[model samples]
Target chain A: MYQFNLHAILGYFGQLPSSILVTLEITLIALGASTLLALPIAKARMSGSRVAALLARAYVELFRNIPLLVLLYVYYFGLAQSGLHLSNFWATILALTTNAAAYGSEIIRAGYSAVPTGQREAARSLGLRPAHIELFVVLPQVVRVILPPFANHCIGVLIGSSIAAVIGVADLSDWMLATGSEAFRYMESFLVAAVIYIGLCQGVAAAMAALDRRSRRGAY
Target chain B: MFATGSVWDYWRVFVNGLVLTVELSFIALVLGFVLGMVIGLGRTYGPHPVRLACLVFTESFRSIPPLLLFFGAFYGLSYTTGVTLSPFQASVIAMVLEASAFISEVVRAAFRSVDRGQWDAARALGLRFWPALRTIIGPQAIRVLIPPTIGVYVAVLKDSSFASIVGLVELTRAGLLVRETVGDSLTVFLLLSGIYFVINFTISSGALALERRFRFAH
Candidate 1:
């Protein structure tokens, strides 16, 4: 008969709270950094300036093609050898941010494209400042159009951050692995991790779904 | 990478690892596709209990992180059941299981996008359920499924790198091995990154071509 143990998991509840915080720290930083980078690249992709578009495309192509794990190694392991050593925490943030930016730019560009070109004409005819046109007219609609994919991007960022654990960053996955190895109760430790991930992801999905509906209902 | 041998020795090791990575990904994708179709069909058209089961399956798997799933499947299963899995087996199982969830979501969306009228009309024309799906709805759903399916494939390819963490000596692990001997982490990893980037770039470009083809056809 297979035996089950809850105590192994319950005992580690103490570490989990802080681990989740670290995970959130990485996730939020990456998301914010990526968004900062993504907006400009998305704009560049749509801009008629061929040079800007080419550079943006190059950035996306490079990051998109490389696996995140390889990027992690390059940032944490490779760059260190070259004498620009970042702590695992910063390295993870940088690697994940770069990756997230590439993907986010593509999604945001798609979102902008999905909007009808007539809207651009409307904004142009309004004689709005260029900045005002993007900030007020283009962005609001793009936000609605991109939210679903954006939510998926957030989830991907969350999952990809698990690689930070590989670099011994003490994030949720790292803590769980440590707990499992310490207790020799790997099953329980992993189950706790799985539960935490599920809860967080489901929470994101629910919040996104609600926002999606609310936005469609003219509550935005 | 040269562990007291020619540079070609380590290059051969990396090649072997890359081959294994490809094999594992191919198996996982094939299994995932079949499992996803089953879950998609069950969720969409099966009886009430089956649909509920499918929904639960897809959502739970989709929400969980692949790494967590990897650890859970690798250690948890053996801990509970006392049945051992090879590292490759465990990792591939984990990949297939989680990927099927995402793939099924893609399938479900694609299937849903097909008009309800088509389904009813197929039935009215005396087509049976499976035949109706195969003959009428399947082709249309394929269009919706293509981009996402390719996206998932690219994801799984990259994701297979995690198998290294679970002790599968795939490409990432091979690079790690090279670093251990050569003590030059950056150059070795940069090489691995370049190889992976090239392969993934090819995949994405192919997907773009396929999407363009679809657009031109339509």
Candidate 2:
């Protein structure tokens, strides 16, 4: 039986903190960018204009169907050939943002749909302006509806960011590869990385659940 | 600076890789369905230990990044067990494990979605457990089971691309190889993405049609 090597794995913990940050940074940036992009896409999808809705639908379908790793390679390597150079970090961010935005748009669109049309009409009849209705009447309910899936999406992004290591973005997966090779302890490093990943996923879940509860309680 | 026209020169290579990708995904989907069914049923109705084991298996596989799992299967297994898995074997194993985890959850939820009254009805009718499930409960749960199951298959198909990192010359890897020789990363990767999009889009559309066909008004 192969002996367990705790010492070699433990020795690599010093380098993990930064890689964890990189993973988080990638996840957060991508999440933010995707959320921003998703708003417009979702709006377009729900809008009255057929051309706009069709374009939005096409955007979501295109990005949703393509694999993230392939998207990353396109931005990281392929773009360079067209004289638009992107560092691995930016490339990863762009790919993840575009990919996640497709799903995010769907989530946001669902949230918007969940808000009954009667709610908007109710707001309008109250003599509220359109912007005020959107802000006070629509946004809050949509936020609540989207919270659970949005949390799940956040967790997905956290996990998906690991793909950044493919383009050598120095994230947690890259650290696992580096540590495994250097210490010749692939199993040990893999276990360590797996623990950190599971921990982060659970943490995101817990935090999101807490936020979801707070939003629910805050709602009337 | 674009050699987009030259990408089709390697159509044979792309076709080979595409075939491999479809074969890998189909095998994994079938095997994952089997394993996921077991785990899902076990989790829902088995004794305590079995349920716990099912939960742990599902959560761990779901929680960990799949690339990490692929690496563990490919490299960690050899290091610890002194047995080597070919890249294809390792990729299939990793994909099945991950896909089954997701599918098991779907299974458990779908099974649970069947009313408790349905089970009592089956027992009252003198139907035994397996017969009750296979005849009554299974049919009801299957509708809930299929659409998300197709979703999981698409996820598995997309994730199978990661198998390239393990040095499998699947579609994505084939594209990388072409890029290496063709020196047109833009054209090559675009071709790769387009092929993936076409396949995935078809599967999703077909799934939607299947779901509609299966729909019944309660």
Candidate 3:
């Protein structure tokens, strides 16, 4: 009979604190960098210039389609050949940022779209400069409306951070893989790893749900 | 570059890898869709235990990265069961299991998104439970289901790359082979990424077109 050993599984958590801290660091950095990149990409996507829109559209389509693993490999291996060598952490961060920016641009673009045409017109009617109108009026509402989806995307970033393991980053998944391999306790290590992921993802989802409810309450 | 292989020299290996990739993806898609439909329905309509099981399955798979699942299924199953599987079989099984969990959520949401009035009307018509679902609920639910279901296909395609870690000789593996042979890592990988981009782009656009047509038709 196959027995489930609870203590062995519980022992895996001895490594959890450090692994989770690394995972959280990756998620936060990736989300922040991606959001910064996404702002301009989203703006360009919604730009009046057809050329700008086309470039942004191509970028999103290209990056969003390719798997993050492939992108990671390309950055880690491909870029290295071109004399732009990056350490595993830098490579992972770059790939995650690139992937997140592509998706976030679309989310933010949808946010931009959600800001009603009337509001833009109202801002324009007030003789406010384009920059001022976007900065003061349209941008705020876009952020507000996009918060729920943005929260969901952040959750996505958190999950997507697991791909960092491929490039040899010592995130949670990498730790699980390493420990499992070393101990030859594949089932216990993997089950524990899966639980950690489930817990983290559920935490993210719960937080996002609360934010969504709060935003809904405040929405006009 | 250390060793050189002509494009023609590697074409056979590349084509073989492509075929295997396509086969793995198709198998995973069909099995995952069926499994997803069952679990999706169960989560929506099954009794408490069934629903909870489905929920646990979905969350467990959804949270863990596909790579971990691939590794776990390959080694963990072998370790626990003494029933060994070939790398290819293990890859397919792992991908299908992971894909099914995600597809289940999409399908369940699609089911729920259909109006409650549809169910009420079906019940009032005196049709039995199975017939009510088959005749009324299934058709409407499928129409709403197509877009997200296609989205799942795109997801599964991208996920197939993870199987390469277990030596599945897919597109990514093919690129790795080229890297090993030609020693030009950049060109080979860039080409592989382009291939993946094209495949995913085609699927995504096809799905989008179908979704648009469905919306217009309805």
- List chain A TM-scores, every candidate, in order: 0.93, 0.98, 0.91
lDDT of 3 by residue, A1-220 (tens): 5455656556567778888888889999999999999989998988899999999999999999888888988999999999999999888889899999999999999988888899989989989999999899987788778887787687778878888787778889888888777777777787877788888888988887887777577567
In terms of docking quality, model 2 is high
* C-alpha DockQ of every model: 0.75, 0.83, 0.70
Residue B34 error, candidate 2, Å? 1.0
- Residue-wise lDDT of candidate 2 within B110-175, one digit each (tens)? 999999999999999999999999999999999889998998989999999999999999999999
Model 1 agreement with the true structure over B101-213: per-residue lDDT tens digits: 98999999999999999988999999999999998999999997897888788888888888888889999999888788877787788889888888888887899899888
What lDDT does candidate 2 reach at residue B139?
93
Work out the TM-score per prediction. Answer: 0.94, 0.97, 0.94
True contacts kept of each: 0.82, 0.83, 0.71
**Comparing candidate 1 with candidate 2, which one achieves the higher DockQ?**
2
Best by lDDT, which number?
A: 2
Displacement of residue A212 (Cα, Å) in model 3 is 2.7
Regarding lDDT, does 1 or 2 come out ahead? 2
Deviation in Å, model 2, residue A88 alpha carbon: 0.6
DockQ value for model 3? 0.70
Give each model's whole-structure lDDT: 0.87, 0.92, 0.85
TM-score of 3: 0.94
Where does candidate 1 clash, by residue pair?
A: A78-B186
Best by TM-score: 2
* lDDT per residue as tens, model 1, A21-57: 9998999999999999999999998899999999999
